[model samples]
Target: MTPDAILALYEWVIGACFRCGDANLFVTPIDAVVTPRGERYPLAACGGCVLDMEEERRRFAERKGEKYHPGRLGRPPA
Candidate 1:
C-alpha cells in the first residue's frame, strides 16, 4: 500500500481506540507511520477494550462535526 493508504489505516485504528474509551490503548501516531514499511505492519489493537464499529461511529460523530457521518461516504444513488 502507498504511504498515504498506510497512514489512513493508522488514523482509522487510533480513532477506533479513542472511541473505545480505553485509556491504556497505545498506537503509533500518524506521524510515526511515515517511516519506511518494514517486514511487519505497524498496526495494533487495545488489549483492554474490544474494538466496536458502532461505538466508534458514535464517538467520532460526537467529537467531529456533524459532517463526519460515514454513511455519506458510501455509494450514492444510481
Candidate 2:
C-alpha cells in the first residue's frame, strides 16, 4: 500500500480499535490526522491476553520505529 493508504488504514484501525475497546491492540500512538512521512506513532500493545499475537504488533512497531523514529524521520523522537 502507498504511504497515504497505509496511513488512512491505520487511522481507520485506530478508530475501530478505540470503539471496540481494543485500543491497546495498536503499537504506535497514531492520530486521526495524516502523519508526515517521518513522524513517529506511539507504541501500542494488544488489548487481549494473547501474547503470541504480539509479534504482529512488534512488526508494526519495528516498521514505525524505522520510518518514524528520530533520525530516520527529520523529527526527534517523542
lDDT of 2 at 4: 38
Total clashing pairs in model 1: 0
Instruction: Give the local distance difference test score of model 2.
Output: 0.35
- Expressed as tens digits, the lDDT of each residue in 1-78 for candidate 1 is 333433333333343333344544454322213346554323333423322332465477788764333322112422
Relative to the true structure, candidate 1 reaches a TM of 0.22
What TM-score would you give candidate 2 relative to the actual structure? Answer: 0.21
Query: Using Cα atoms with residue i matched to residue i, what is each candidate's TM-score against the true structure?
Result: 0.22, 0.21
- What lDDT score belongs to each candidate, Candidate 1 first? 0.37, 0.35
lDDT, model 1, position 54: 26
Query: Tens digit of lDDT per residue, candidate 2, span 3-77?
Result: 333333322223223223454244333234336876654433223312323334446679778532211121234
Task: Indicate which candidate wins on lDDT.
Answer: 1
